[model samples]
Target: MAAAVASLYRRVLPSPPAVDFASPEGKRLFAEALAAGTMEGFFPLVSCFQTQSEPAFCGLASLAVVLNALSIDPGRRWKGPWRWFDESMLDCCEPLDKVKAEGITFGKVACLARCSGANVQSFRANLATIDDLRRHLVRCVSSQDCHLIASYHRQAFKQTGTGHFSPIGGYHAGQDMALILDVARFKYPPHWVPLRLLWDAMNMTDDSTGLLRGFMLISRKTAAPSSLYTVSCRDENWKSMAKYCVEDLPNLLKGDNLDNVQTLLSRLIESLPAEAEALIKWVVEVRRKEEGDPSLSKEEKERLFLKENVLQQVRDTRLFAIVHDLQYANNPCCNCSSSSEEDSLTRIAAAVCCQGAAMLSGNLASRHGFCCKETCLKCIQANGDGLKTVISASVVSEGNEHGVDMLLPMSSPGASSCNSNLKNNVVKYPSSADVLTVLLLALHPSTWLGIKDEKLKAELQTLVSTDNLPDDLKREIMHLRRQLYYLKTCKEKEEYEDDDLPSPKWLG
Candidate 1:
């Protein structure tokens, strides 16, 4: 009876002891790292810092290093529905004993990084060979585009330690070694380790997942907008589109087009000769310099800016020239020119940028023409007849000349049950940034490319396959695909063809 009662109530395990903080050797090592420019440089991490007051937190400590490196502002844009993930809510900083007891996992850590907008990718290390490990370092850490979080067993590497997490700052290829920026400063100093040893360490099985401990790469996510947004071809909207497209051009050119203009121009921005980068920056300064000068009247200032800042030299680069040429080669751009010289330069920049986006996304870019700004592909389809007329005429059309109203009701007869069932319960996206892309993909059956039944599952499978793609994105695509599939099926059953369908407001 006594043994049975004891078995019914488990004993609370004691927390692990903390690492020594004030050791003289630890301070010296930290100072050396500071001198080597290892920390994020925003703030100093003292010798005594540990992620948790009690128990092991090498993972949390390592995470702090990466987040700090990314210049993450813990207070801004990070507090939302996912605020539960904030440092304040974390067991390390918060008094959440239960959470501390539960600990963190590779999956949880990866999710947090994604939520923080880091393009994070993880690979299993159990099967990684020594050469495979070298390749990972060369492609990730050595490239400088990513900071790696290494999960490995210290004992496996012959270190008097257990499982540990840390970042690798760089690689010494000639030496066949890596610079380990260990976050557990008190336990282990930052140092160089041979590739073979590191590989063996990574191959250690993780206690939590029953999988080999490996590494994750975190960097800024691809900042380009998808191919769905396009430059408007309509006369009224073209000017505004041109002006707005300048800042967005770099990304637009780099979107998902098969031609991939970025293949040729991706590195052009950074690869520019110093003189060219200076010249690009100077172009904007030319106008600003005039704006600040006291001697020049407003009119003279404008003249100087136009003459000096808007230089043919700046525009003559191989990059801008190709972009500008592509814009002109495009048809229907004949006389939609801007009246103001300032507006002209702005529009030129916009055209160049739009062309760049077209290159990146493999989508056709419009130069001076109007593009339909409808929210959904169905809306675009509803205006297909008008779109053809306007596009073919090679001229700007105004104000729904083809009567661009929604052709399908928000709730169709066949889809009403499905739509109603999932309406309020639809999965929410972590960010609204990629809605246009998902909406476009959900348009029609042929576009589905044979993904008919279980369309939502198919869409999710496609999204989940993307490296470092967030779970929220997969959920969003699933919800949108569900709505779209139902809508398409319902529309097919309707007797009326395109024009006879419901009006544009149905998209609401």
Candidate 2:
């Protein structure tokens, strides 16, 4: 049955476009394929990364592979299968043994081998000397296009504690300075570092709130993937990671109420070094002017000073336009409006953003106050009546109880109703009273009116007449009929209408 379902999914879903390594169009298509959820496209995409010599693409491709696998079999809870595959591909020990016979550093070769399977217990145990690992890792880092190698090194330093050369401060401070330089080189290279690293670094230092900002950065950077993206992206581990990230973020934010923008900005600024103090001071001044009571002239002077400094730095980096664009979005000069609908949408968008952010940010928000169970409870509490009605209606229609508790209104009664009727020797309806009880439960909230299933409605209508149901169900059904009729009559006579209705001006 599962195979049939999988086949049907494929039959209905079109294959992704072919990726060409030679052209920008090819890269875009590959990215699209990765984003579209095509698991099968992941390997091909990663292959493109290898050919293009673009490390960012390689890191992203690996991520896509991991994410795709998770999406397909989230229930399986697979662990580090990629590490196994990576190790098998390198087979470093055989070559290393041959090289050992020659008495060379052989660092580059060791690094390459380790990159594939650094997570493996054997690799972790063996890659002892930083120079040996750094030699290989640094080759990729210096190349600027070796994203996979860079990523592997970053992971290695993070995991194995590279003596004095940890990219991240305070981990292995007393280790060799050369090793530390290697770690730092991979981390803060002149060119683009993987966004995942930036995000992870931020999360490891800060908390859930910090992670949320990272996700917003991703959403702003990349285009969203469709169902096809999943297939093409095809890294089960990556998919799982992404899903876990997405699901966990909202729960994390909700737990601590870290929703303040000011708090977020402060955290970002705090993450910088002492050399960044001037920049931080400038940021604070600008923020104060924006939110402070100051003379117009003073505000103008402050703004001009900040702009001149920013422009100077932009020119120095030769990234003026990009900096201008970023500043434009962050600046108050941009004309943006807030609406109630926009607010609601932002909340939903934030939820989605958190998902991707959560994964790349490591498991930052996975702990803390973010509890899925709590989120579920809050969702139920917020829409108590509506959810109860929907669950009740689903239960009545499905006629089974998989695990749903009608007693707990938020419990999805549909699962219960579907499962209950399947059991052997169980009285399906129990009695007419049970039928009427379910109907009354369904009618309590306005949300039920939106349930458009004709058959479900028809089944409900059948219950309106007591004759078809068992005695107990019939009794309950009659009670509902009485209550509904009374309300209808009361409504017609205006007895339930507000007494504060005003008289017309002409009558006055």
Model 1 residue runs over 4 Å out of place are 1-54, 72-99, 223-508
lDDT of 2 at 355: 29
Most accurate candidate by lDDT = 1
Off by over 4 Å in 2: 1-122, 125-131, 147-508
Span of ten consecutive residues with least summed lDDT in model 2: 212-221
Error in Å for residue 212 of model 2: 32
- State TM-scores per candidate: 0.35, 0.15
lDDT of 1 at 92: 17
Model 2 C-alpha lDDT per residue in residues 163-243, reported as the tens digit of each score: 111111001111111111122222231122223333332223112111111110000101111100011111123233223
lDDT of every predicted structure (CA atoms): 0.38, 0.24
> How far in Å is the alpha carbon of 483 misplaced in model 1?
19
lDDT, model 1, position 77? 18
